[model samples]
Target chain A: MQYLSVVDVARHFGRRKALSQISFSCAAGEMIGLLGPNGAGKSTLLNILATLIAPSKGEVKYGDQGANDGADVRAQIGMLGHDLFLYPELTARENLEFFAHLYGVTDVHSTATRALHTAGLVDRGDDFVAGFSRGMRQRVALERALLHEPKLILLDEPFTGLDQTSTAALVGRLRERQRAGCLIVLATHDLDVADGVLSRAIYLKDGRMVGSDTGSSNLADRYRRAMDRGPRNADSALWGGE
Target chain B: MMRAFFRVAWQVMRKDMTVEIRSREILLTTLLFAVSVVLIFSFALVREGRAPDDVAAGILWVAISFSGTLAMGRTFERERYNDTLRALILAPADRPAIYVGKLLGLLLLMLLVEIVLVPMVGLLFAAPIFAYPGMLLMLLVSGTLGFAAVGTLFAAMLVRVRSRDTLLPVLLYPITVPVMIGGVRGTAALFQAVPDEPMARFWIGLLLFWDAIFVTLALWTFEPVMTE
Candidate 1:
C-alpha cells in the first residue's frame, strides 16, 4: 500500500537551479509521462528519484521511508538515463550477468538469457556491445533496466536513437511492466510517444511543474497552453533568447 | 550480506577479466609501457664500474609507479566510455565492492607485469633478485596492494572530472608517496650487493601499514566520492 512521493524537492547546481518545488506522488500501476522541452529538469527529477543525486531542499519518500534510507529505496528502483550504462567491451550476456550478480539475482545465466530474449538480442548475446548499433545498444540497456524486476522504473529519454521497430518493442515491454503493477516514470520531450503510452502526463518548464492531468486530450495542446506564460524568469538566459 | 558483497566483487572482477581477455588492451599497453621504461632506465643508468644494484631499485619502482598509473587509467577508461560506472553505482550492490573488485583486477595486472619485469631486470642488471625471495614478494604484494587500493578510488573519483587524464597522476602521486617510498627503499635494500635485512623489513612493514590505512580510507570514501 506504500507509494513514492516527492514533496517540495529542489536541486541547484551553484547559481543554476535544476529543479524547484516539484511535488508529486505515484503508486504502482501508474505510468506517469514527464513532458518537458530541453532544460526543463525532467532528467534531474528522475535522477533525484533514482537517488543518483540528492535534492537541495525538501524530501523524497519511498513508502514511509525517505532518501536517507538508501539501500531499501535503491533496491526497488531501476533507471535508464542519457548514458546507456552498458559496457561496450563486455558482451551483452556478460553485461547482464555482472549486473545480475550485483542485483542479487539468482540463476544469473537464466536471467540474462531471458532478458536478452526479451530485448530481441538473444542470438547476439555473446557479441561485444562495442560492435552494436546505437539502437541495438539501447535495446540491451532496456533489458538491463528490467532485469531485476524493480518496482519503480525511471526512463529518461528512453526513445532516443531507437528505430520504429525497437521503439515499439520498448513501448510494449513498458506497458507490460505497468500492467504487472510497476510504477513507471517516463521522461521525454516527445509528446506523441507520451500521448500514446502515458496514463497521466505532467508538464514541466524551467524546473517548475506547470500542469499534470489524467485527461484524454491532446498532450501537445495542453503542453502549449500550460507553457503560455511568456517567461518565468526574464533574466535567466535559458529562456532569454536562443 | 557479507557473502553477497564478495559475490558481487567477484562478478565485477570476473567481468573485467573477460573483457580484458577479449581485448588484451590493458595487458599489452601496460606490459609494453613498463618494459620500455625499464629498458630505457637500464641504458641510462649504466655508469662504468658500478653494479646494477646501486640504481636498480629506484629505476624499477619508477617504472612501476608510472606504468601503474597507465594501468589505473586504462582500468577506468572503459567504464567511462559508455557510462558503465553509473550503472555500477546504480546497482543495488555495495559500492565498496566495486572498489575491491577493481583493486583486485589492477593488482592482477600489476603482478603480472612485475613477474616479467622482475626477471627481465635480474637478467639485464645481473643483480641477484632471488637473494631475499620472501622479502621481495612481500614488498611487491604490499606495494601493489596499496597502489591499486588508492589508485582505484582516485580513478573512480576522477572519472567525472573534465581533466581526468591529467588529474589522475596529479592526485594519485601525492597520496601514494608512502607506498612508493616503501617500495623503493625495500627494493634498494634487497638489490644491494650486500642485503640489509632490517632495512628491508622496516620498509615492508611500512608498505603493509600504508596498505591498511589507505585501503580502509578508500573503502570509506569510495561510495561518497563515486555517488557525488
Candidate 2:
C-alpha cells in the first residue's frame, strides 16, 4: 500500500516563517484532519505537499520517493485549494474534460461524465460556472480535483461556504473515497466537522505542530487543549504528550 | 514523452478555442481594438496630407501590437478570475506544454484579427500588400510568433500582479522591440512605392532569429516563473 511521509518540512516567505520543522506520516486508508487557527500554515503545508510550492527545508515523500520537482510525484496528489481553479466561462463538463486531458486520462469524455455524476452536477454540467452559486461552484471544483482519480487528496477548507445539504453530500462522497483506500488530508477550522469525519487530527499553530490526536477520540477538545497550551514553553510537553 | 507534451498543449489550445468561440469576448475586443487603431491612423495620416501607403507598415504593425496586447490581457484575465492558471500548472504534464499551449491560442486569435486587418489596410491605404501575398504572410507569421512568444511569457508572469493590465505592455514592448522593428521594416519593404526585396529579406531573417531565441527562452523560463 502507498503512504506519505513528510519530514521536518519548513517554508519561509522572505523573513517570515510560514511553516517550520513540521513532520508527520500517514498511510493509505487513513483520514487525517489538519486543524489550525488562522495563519497557522494549513494552506502552506498543503501547498508544499501538493508540490505547488517547494519547501524551504526538509522533504515530502510518497512511498520511498521524494516529492522532487517532477510531474511523476505530483501526478498522484489531488488538491482543492482556497482557489477553486475552475474556469467560470467554461461549463462544468468542459472544465472537467480539459483537466482530464491534462492529467492524461485515457478517455476524457467518459471520465469527465463520471466525475460530473460523482459531484452531483450531471444535470448542471452544461451550465457556465459563472452563473453557479457558491455551493455549485464548490461541487464543480470537487469534481475537477477528483476528475483524474488521484490517490492522495488534499482539501483546504473544503467545507467553507457549503450549505448543510451540500456539505452532507460532499462529506458522503469523501467518506466513500476514503473507504476505497485513498489517503486523505483535510484542513479545516471547523472542529465539529473534523471530529465527525477524521480518524486522527494534527494540530498546528504559529508554524509548528502543537500536537496530534491518534486515539480517535475527543478531537475538538484535544485540539483546543493543544492550541491553548501555546508554543512558547510547551513544545517539549506537546512532543511528550503526542 | 514528447507526444504527451504536444498532446497536452493541443488540449489546452483546444479548450481555449472552445471558450473563445462561446464567449466571443477576446475575439470581438481584439478586432474592435485593431480596427479602431487602423481607422484612427488613417484619419491622422490623411490629415497630415501623407499617402497612407508611405507609412502603411508602421500603421499595420502598431495596430497589431496594440491589439495583440489587448488579446493577451483578456486571455489571462479570465484565467485570473477563476484561478485556472493554478489548474494548468497542477496538471501532470510537462511545464513547457502549458506555455506552448497558451502561445498557440494567442497566435490563433491574433491571426484571426490580422486576416481582417490585412485586407482592410490594403484596400484603405492602397499599400499593395496583396501584390506579394506569400512574402507578406511570411513576414506576418514570423513577427507575430516572435511577439506572442515574449508577450505570452510576460502575461503569465504578471497574472497576479496588481496592475497587470498596464504592466504587461510596459514590460512587453521594451523586450519585443527587435520583433516590432523587424516586422515594421519587413512590411515597409513590401509596402514601398518601389519594394525593396533585399531589405525585406534581411528583416525577415532577423524576425525569424528573434522568434527562435524568445520561444526557446519562454519554454525554459515558464516553469520556474509560473510555479513560484
Candidate 3:
C-alpha cells in the first residue's frame, strides 16, 4: 500500500513557480531519492510533504488517507531538513530531553540517552551544542528526528556536512529504519550518495518530475541525458534563480 | 493537555535558566541598564524636589519596562543563534505548546529581573517602596504579565526582521503605553498609602483585562508568524 502520495502538487512563491504539477508516491519501506540541481524544487517538494508549506494546488495523502486530516498525517511522519533544529545554548541531553517532551515520548530520559549514544556523542551529551562541530550537531539533529520513531522519514540533503564515519553511521541507521518498514524520501544533489543509498530514483527538472528509474543502471548518466534533452523553457526561471 | 503544556513550559524555563547561569550576559546587562536609567532619572528629576511618591511608580515601571524589552530580545537571540526554535517548531507537538513554553520562559526572566530591580530602586531613591507590600506586589504581577505577554509576540516578529535589537523597543513602547500608565497609577496609589482607592483597583483591573486580551492575540498570531 502507498504510505505517501503527492498528486499534481503545484507551488508558487510570488511570480515564480517553485514547483509545478509535481506528482509521486511511495510504498511501505521504500527508499526514494529525489535527484535535482539547485532550485529544482527538491526542498520545496520536501517542504510540502513535511507540511511546512502548503501546496498551491494538489493533494497529499498518507496511509491511503486523505490530506484534510493533517494531524493524523503529521503524527506518522518525521522530518529532517537543511536547518539545524537543536537549540545551541542547550546541552545535547537537554535538547533531546526537550524534544522528547514535545513529542510526548513515554520514557524521555532513556530515549534521550539512547539517542545520544546513537549519535556517537554519549560523552558530550551534557555539553552545549554551541561547542559542537557541524558533524556533531548533525548527529544530534538526526537523533531528534528519530526520537518519535516515526513511520515515514523525510530527509533533505542529510549528508551535507558529515565526516565519512558519521556518514556511514547515518546510512547504516537509515538502512535499519528502512528494514523496519519506514518509508524514506531523501532529496539531494549528490548522485553518488543517492545511487548508493536509494533503491529507486526520481529526477526533477524545471520544477517537475522529468524522469524516474528503478533499475541498477547508472542513474546519474540517465539523469544528465534526460536534462540535456529536456525543454529549455521548462525551467528557465529556476535556472535564473528567481 | 494542560499537563503537557505546563511540562513543556517548565522545560523551556529550566533550559533558559541554565543558559542564563552559564552566560550571565543578559541578566547583567539588563540589571546595569535598569540601574543606570534610575540614576539618570534621579539627576534629571529627583533634584527638583519632586516628591518620591509623585514619580516613584513612573520611574519603577519605566525602568522595568525598558529593561524588559532588552531581556525579551535576548530570548529569541539565544534560539536564533543555534536554530533551536526552528527545531522546536518542527516537533510533533502543537504550536501553542511552543508558544506557551517560550512565553513562560520570558515571563520568568522578566519577573526575576524585576525582583532584584524593585528593591534596588527603593534603596537608590530612598522611597518607601516596601511600605505597602501587597500593593507593590500586585503592581509587579499585573505589570510584568502584561509586558511579557505582548513582548513575547513582538520579540518573535522582530527576531526575523533586521535591526531587531533596536526595533523591538521602538515597536513595543508605543503599544505598551497603556499598560505602563496603568502600572504606574496602580503603584503610585500604593505608595500614597491608598490601598482601598478605586482608581488603583481600576488600573489593576485594566492591566488584567489587557493581559488576557493580548495573551490570546499572541497565541493566535504566533503560529502563523513562527511557521512563516
Candidate 1 structure quality by residue, lDDT tens digits, A1-242:
64789999988887777777789898889899988778888988998899888899989988887776766778888888778998887889988888888888888999999999988899999998889998888888988988889999999898887788878888998999999999999898877767758888888888888888886668888778877752466336343231
Our tally of clashes for model 3 stands at 0
In model 1, residue pairs whose N, Cα or C atoms come closer than 3 Å (at least 3 residues apart or on different chains), thus clashing, are: none
DockQ for candidate 2: 0.67
RMSD of each: 2.3, 3.5, 2.9
Candidate 3 residue lDDT tens string, B85-180: 766666666676677777787777777778887886676666677676876777788888888888888888777677998888888888888888
Worst 10 residues of 3 chain A by lDDT: A233-242
Q: What is the C-alpha lDDT of each candidate?
A: 0.86, 0.87, 0.80
Fraction of the real A/B interface contacts present in each candidate?
0.73, 0.75, 0.53
iRMS per model, in Å, is 1.1, 1.1, 2.2
Ranking by TM-score: 1, 2, 3
Name the best candidate (by TM-score).
1
